[model samples]
Target: MSETQKSKPEIEAPQSPAPEALEIVDLVEGDGAEATPGATVDVHYLGVDYDSGEEFDSSWGRGQSIQFPLQGLIQGWQDGIPGMKVGGRRQLTVPPQLAYGPAGSGHPLGGKTLIFVIDLLGVK
Candidate 1:
């Protein structure tokens, strides 16, 4: 067999399962209650590629959280953060539809399962 064919099984087998097939890991529960779509929130986050567990971005290294309008972010963020309260940490496994979609939207996130560890620091 060619090298490409031999390696294909090894690469595809492990990552074949869909993101939805994996369980979510919730680390902390927020105290201030859940967020809303238009709410501005301060959050510390780490984004990784679900299949690879590769670090994509992190706010914790900055020694501060970042703030953004929930509704303005990717569908994953908009849909995922509301149930989270201030001071809560949750993992989001976002399927491609809720993530960068097909074209990637400029970031390195396109047609992939995006994993996010989010800490909802505050609401403003």
Candidate 2:
């Protein structure tokens, strides 16, 4: 007896239009010190393409964290990250102007908006 195998269908991810302005949403406000400019911060972040909801980066999935000066990040991050305290979790919907700009990064992400959910672990 010869039988054919059945294949499951793949589901598409949700998409959103590019934001006109930066959107900041605080999921969990921490009780620690705020992340001021020039402060070194450790964070776990998930970055996705706003138009297609495609994941671009994630520190949590890597089972690791990143530490960098707050000012070193993009304008949206620099503006949004401040006031976020250690242990805080925030969602940032960044416009193209605040992200990689009209040129974007590369390929599919070009001239598109980006969304990032970041967790502030520590500040130094």
Candidate 3:
């Protein structure tokens, strides 16, 4: 983490009727390099269930950011994160099919829509 890093962000609960497809919204656009589909990204992110409005994961909660290969993440992330630049903040609303899949698929978050707020730190 850098000294310029922002503190953890707060995600508001979403209203009913999650979108049927992936939704990407840029909260803060960055001036740094843009991310490519094959890039490895370092980011701080929070994920919550759209229906429950309960946090399910967070890199900020761990007091550190995480670096992951884009291909290794869920389909929603893979589709949503590219084109985002380092230092940007983005929100993604992901339906079950793009998140973990429908209920009984065994991933816990399966069958649920998910909301993620991501702060991009670096891309390589």
What value does the lDDT take at residue 88 in candidate 3? 88
lDDT of 2 by residue, 1-124 (tens): 0011011112134354556999998877777878987789888788887767778887766777889997888888998898898767788988888877677366455577788888787899
The best-first sequence of candidates by TM-score reads: 3, 2, 1
Stretches of candidate 2 off by over 4 Å are: 1-16, 104-108
Q: Which window of ten consecutive residues has the lowest lDDT sum in model 3?
A: 1-10
Candidate lDDT values, in order: 0.69, 0.75, 0.90
| Candidate achieving higher lDDT, 2 or 3 | 3
RMSD of 1: 11.4
- lDDT at residue 122 of model 2 (Cα atoms): 86
**Which residue pairs clash within candidate 1?**
none
Candidate 1 lDDT, 16-94, residue by residue in tens: 5656532355666656756887799888787777678667777755666689898779888888887677767777778
RMSD of 3: 1.8
Encode model 3's per-residue lDDT on 1-124: one tens digit a residue.
3333477767788776899999999988877889999999999999999988899999988998899999999999999999998888889999999999999999999999999999999999
- The TM-score, computed over Cα atoms with residue i paired to residue i, of candidate 2 is 0.81
Model 1 regions lying over 4 Å from their true place:
1-16, 20-25, 103-107
